[model samples]
Target: MGTGVVVRALSGRYELLDPLGQGGMGVVYRAHDRELERTVAVKVLPAQMLRDADFLARFRRKARAAAGLSHPNIATVFDIGEDAQDGEPIPYLVMELVEGETLGDLLRRTPLTPAQAGQIATAVLEALEHSHGRGIVHRDIKPADIMVRFADFADFADSQARVKVMDFGIAKLMSETATRLTSTGMRIGTPAYMSPEQADGRPADARTDLYSTGCVPYEMLTGRPPFTADSPAAMRFQHIYSRPPG
Candidate 1:
């Protein structure tokens, strides 16, 4: 498709509109699906990324991993397809359009109270519990990867919000390519929140996500990640050796 041109996908069923954001791997666009008659989010890898056979394979793997999951706290994957516009293959993923700010974005404005942060962490743990039960480890669970939607919670001591986890990794997809696409020496998962095993480049399991999960609430309540470093390598070293502040 041409720049600034509105194009249809899946044989003119979905209409693409202005982009929502661009990340290292894909650009997300707000779109309309005539068949469903509702707004949705579409994430697409640039046409150039498609040329790499390995990347394409990993892309499909990530899509499948997210697609297999079904939970309210997890973003819903609606469809996966390649653009048929003029033979340029741009792979795209259709997802539920969430209306809220990321936990990271909210924290930047002001830190949350302990009670509020605890509530958010509880919701995230609920989501993680489900994924873990199915043998899926999120691998990346920082504040930026968590979404908070407005809701009522008067009965509970926790904050009134619904949490949604974003960007659950599909094994090798993140381990191999995320940093490569960004031209950064750092690994895919943010350094501060990375579990020791992940930071050390050891194979990760469900416990890896649990380690990152512990880091989220620390930042939420304290306004900083448990560890800090000037560089990715330094951060990895801290994760492997330093103890978090009490």
Candidate 2:
């Protein structure tokens, strides 16, 4: 909390190597598991926000829920641990180091044929189905939250592509407190993909995920998000009332 950084080995086992990506809560890193002798992704949550006993309890519960998932299309959560940094406990989750490009990055660089889009969509649905069955609703679903790997981009096929849906129970933790999270510089739900209920600050259910997932494929095929507006506020309005472009 004092330093505004998580720069040391977690629990003296997971060594932070390179930062992979970052979001509102914390940064994810490509790390080495000295104990297990393997490569893994470590997501370190901000230290200051976790000092409260109630908040830390909630984090452990949600992290456990996210780690319980098992599916081919969902990245695996291997472990959760904490490290002391200047007398503060920094929590971190060890996850599978998925080797792939984010779907959002892919779309920016390459065009997806209908076949490729369909394959990716099916994989996402399957992942969602498994999570929804477990009563975990991914409140935030967007292109960036999905990772896709292919045997080779030049000769893409259904069998060659692998899809993994990420940050499942993570968003659900932020769902009930969108205003507070936003105040802390955390993005709640992505505008273009959020359902009407989410845009209106309502609790999300399985249908909310379906609504957001529908937008992913729609964007994949159309070369743009189905609905676009000048600002995030306007985008939320469109999500609530307007139909996306066909």
Candidate 3:
């Protein structure tokens, strides 16, 4: 492994070209997979977060579980490996390279029409149905986590597009860590769209994702989430107490 803002991993099998995005979980990069001869998305977790032995085992187990999922609307997880930089094992997951802006970015430009919104909702529900049937719950489902796959990257505001759900088991992985969440500096779930049970630190099941499934389409149709707040804690509170706007 190399060092600095851009680096290669797994003995140069994947070359980090540029960063796609960063969040509470990790930084995702647009990368070149030399072995496969195709572009891919690589999520490199913050090195220190997965350093512990027990947590590292859990991370691999969960990643392997997510890899079993296969669906057209679910971003495919291709492989997982560690990039040991200076003996610090930084783990990464290779995913299908989806070329499109996030639904969050698309909505920032304009809200979707009912027709388009319906399409996205249908796809998301189908994706959830498939995952739920397999007993996997996507604890965090929001616009940012949904990729609106482009027929063409140039058409940022396409009226119709397919959606691919990303980060399938990430929230579950965060919660399963042997260490406290404070140690990893990662939020367990996104607040505004989280189910009331999830927001309150209660056990979440398939219904939790269905709750967010409804929330995302509402935001797509209305240009705003069902609830909003000045802080993460406040947003979670609203999900627990305040009724959703009608």
Q: In lDDT terms, which candidate is top?
A: 2
Per-residue CA lDDT of model 1 for 96-149, tens digit only, reads: 888787898889976676778888899888888888887778887888778886
lDDT for each candidate structure: 0.76, 0.83, 0.80
User: What TM-score, over all chains together, does every model reach?
Assistant: 0.86, 0.91, 0.89
- Candidates ranked, most accurate by TM-score first: 2, 3, 1
- 22 Cα displacement, candidate 2 (Å): 1.5
In terms of TM-score, the best-performing candidate is 2
List model 2 lDDT by residue over 122-230, tens digit each: 9999999999999988878899889998888787653577899888887766444444555656555558888999888887799999999999999999999988888
User: Which portions of model 2 miss their true places by more than 4 Å?
Assistant: 1-7, 51-53, 175-178, 184-189
Instruction: Note the residue pairs that clash in candidate 3.
Output: none
The superposed Cα distance between candidate 2 and the true structure at residue 65, in angstroms, equals: 1.5
lDDT of 2 at 167: 82
